[model samples]
Target: MRDIMGMMGKVKEMQAKMEKMQEEIAALEVEGKSGGGLVTVVMTGKGELKSVKIDPALFKDDDVEILEDLLVAAHKDAKDKVEAVAAEKTKAMTAGLPIPPGFKLPF
Candidate 1:
């Protein structure tokens, strides 16, 4: 049927758009910092950690636990930012879709 063909075409178009969006998200980066900017982490929108930075002042033998905590916090902050970016991109991609409430996309 003509209607079915048209619907299929739209679905294909949406799939292509989603693929492009995912590529863009994969190329995006976000940065997060903690401990008054003493610790920082960079991550991609796909949640891959790109890098981490630490202030040289934190380099000492007595504060290993504190340094570890700061690193954890910075990594968490970066992950949160990455998730936010992915969610925003997904919202834009699925803006008009009829997906049910509380239905999360399997990314």
Candidate 2:
């Protein structure tokens, strides 16, 4: 049927768009900071940690626990940002699609 053929065409187009979006997301970098910028983390949109930075002031032996906490917080913040970016990209890619309400794409 013509309708079925049209839907298939749309599906192919969506697939191409999704692949492009994935590549773009993988190339994105996000930064997150914690402890008043004493610690910072950089992560890719796929949630892979790219790097971490810590202020020299937090390098004292007695502040090991504090440094650890800051690192964790910074990493979490970066990951959250990455997730938000991915969500935004997905929303834009799926706009105007006939997906049902409350249906979430399995990413």
Candidate 3:
């Protein structure tokens, strides 16, 4: 009974920490670039698209397909960065927890 209660307390604490982490992530902004910096994407840590930029030279070609590809690449870069940051933060948050080695958090 005591162990169960203690586990419940830990779960509540983890929930609170996750909430705080989400807020922190939402406030962060990350930038990703592709095509040698010709195309750039800005996104929040929560993966929300904020803005996009394209170099004037890229527009000269007026190649819609190429532009689409670059945009996709840039978005992927930003998303990868967001995931990396989230993983790092989660690791820090759960540093001292007793979770099993192969267990994954629902976050």
* Candidate number of the best lDDT: 3
Clashes of 2: 0
Which runs in model 2 stand beyond 4 Å of their true positions? 100-102
Error of 2 at 53 (Å): 0.7
Q: Is candidate 2 or candidate 3 better by lDDT?
A: 3
Q: Estimate each model's TM-score.
A: 0.89, 0.90, 0.85
Q: In each prediction, how many residue pairs overlap at the backbone (N, C-alpha, C within less than 3 A)?
A: 0, 0, 0
lDDT of 1: 0.87
lDDT of 2 by residue, 1-107 (tens): 99999999999999998999889888889999999999999999888889999899876677688888999999999988888888888888898878887676765
For residue 77, model 3's alpha carbon misses the true position, in angstroms, by 0.4
Q: Give the per-residue lDDT digits (tens) of candidate 1, residues 25-84.
A: 888898989999999999887878889999999986678999989989998998888778
Which wins on TM-score, candidate 1 or candidate 3? Answer: 1
| Clash pairs, model 1 backbone | none
lDDT of each: 0.87, 0.88, 0.89
